[model samples]
Target: MQVLRWDGGGPMLATRDSSTLTVLIGTFAVLWLLWAIKKQRKAAVHPLPPGPRGLPIVGYLPFVGTELHTKFHQLCGIYGPIYKVWLGNKLSIVISSPSLVKEVVRDQDAIFSNRDTNIVGRTITYGGADIALSLNCPNWKMLRKIFVREMLSPTNLDITLALRREEVRKTIRNVYDKKGTHIDLGDLAFITVMNAIMNMLWGGTLRGEEGAKFGAEFKHIFAELVMILGKPNVSDLFPALARFDLQGIRRKAKRISETIDRVLDYAIDKQIKSLAKAKEEGTTKTEQKDFLQVLLELSEQDDGAPSMIMTQIKALVFLS
Candidate 1:
């Protein structure tokens, strides 16, 4: 600078900085415009209640903190019964008052029937075929009807009571066997619950070591899946960038999902083969039907379009 030498670096550095500043300014302007448009559209439909505003990219999600209930309590004090919080790109409306909840659930049930699901939710639910994530459509209606009217009806519950009793007795026996020694209460309880649930799902389709291994695998995978789903993924925020999977969330989800799918395949195939053998031998089928048997029967029904399919069956098993 003292000599004002004609070294090429100074002017080029200034030019690069100028270009970077322009790009950042342009990006901010575009973001603001899009946000403004979205606000306008939401206002046009119905003006949302007020809440704390957040940063540019991430919203209130970062500040939600570990004590979510406490944060919610604070927000309720400030924003009253109803308020909206932006979770990254997702807009979540929180209703604190019971009356407002009733108004939304009972009065406007149809409008609120379908809920938004993220990429991991869709991937794990097999594109929303399962009851947990399926859209409110004819298929969903059918699935719900079958689930409630057949699998969870009072009659089915009574029929499956024995299975529950058996699992409880198994736990009791194990505890009795380990009475003199130190026993892991948590492991004991978990295995008992898993056994009971599997019995209700498909009777003995998974039992002993198979049930234990499958439950362990499923539990670990599902925990990871939930974490990935809850974490902020660039792909989820910007749908266009999903194909790139820059964060690799999708790849991890797919790998775990395939492992689950394989387990489901084995269970379904084993059950089908068992049913076929029972039919071939002309043995009287068990009067108490597990959820899987009901699903298989529904899948086989030829009247009025197939109500369920193998994919749907797999999803139901996974959900169970």
Candidate 2:
């Protein structure tokens, strides 16, 4: 049997096949032209921050690697104090030197106050529910004010100082007990600070294995979120490629978010149930007049009136 070939051999290939090939080429050409036009339009609208040139699609993602701070610092040394870096479709301005940081953060705070909404931040902070991660808006402003007034105010601190003192004394006692043993000072200091913060936020101590587990999980989730946001994200650099979500960043963010939500929900539900019982019994006495109690009281007021809720309280707790 003779083998057929593209070359002029046997019967010539059909004219229809050549026409189909022509149509395919034309289609690809038109699509590419349209894409170029769209890209040009976007470029005209939002001029990208000035930075070192990068590869197409991936941008400077490969160059960033994992150590974001180190990579940014290195780039800053070469490109001066302020420079831009791309991760996939996203662009970020890196402020390295203290002078530049002061200029942007202190002087131009109004311009930079509104945070850039990133996929990672949105997921980890419960769709921007947390004050630290939320965008600058009316809700954020109100929450921030409440946080300052209710949690971090000078009067609140005065009330909480006794608790802080007790926690610190316990920490010192524990350190003294471990004097004979090989104690990790770093671990001890971390636990001390964490316990102080937790006690202030929850009006309780983080003791025993169960509390340890919660602390470990919370720390891991928080650290992961900070790491993800701090690093160069490809999705932010290239918005077009954001849908692809390479590196599974969005999935990881969602998983971390769910874990945080579970913890916060458990705490809030307990507080709400206790508050409901107290109201039903008509008891003016409270076992503990904690931040949660104050928030519940505020939430009971008219919706039109200024109020606070579990979400805002939880955000304040985290911020504290």
What is each predicted model's overall lDDT from 0 to 1?
0.80, 0.71
Find the candidate with the highest TM-score and give its number.
1
TM-score of each: 0.78, 0.70
**Candidate 1: misplaced stretches above 4 Å?**
1-44, 182-187, 207-213, 226-234, 238-241
- For model 1, give the 10-residue run with minimal summed lDDT: 1-10
Model 2 TM-score, all chains together: 0.70
lDDT per residue for candidate 1 within 1-320, as digits (tens), equals 12233566653224556668999999999999999999999888977889989877678878988887799889999999999998777778888899999988899977887987778878877888898888888888888887888778898788788778888998899889888899888978877887788777866566678867876777777778878977777777667788999999888888878998998888788778878888899984565467777688778778986478777888887786
Q: lDDT for model 1, on a 0 to 1 scale?
A: 0.80
Task: Tell me which residue pairs clash in candidate 2.
Answer: 87-234, 88-234, 88-238, 89-236, 89-237, 89-238, 89-239, 90-236, 90-237, 90-238
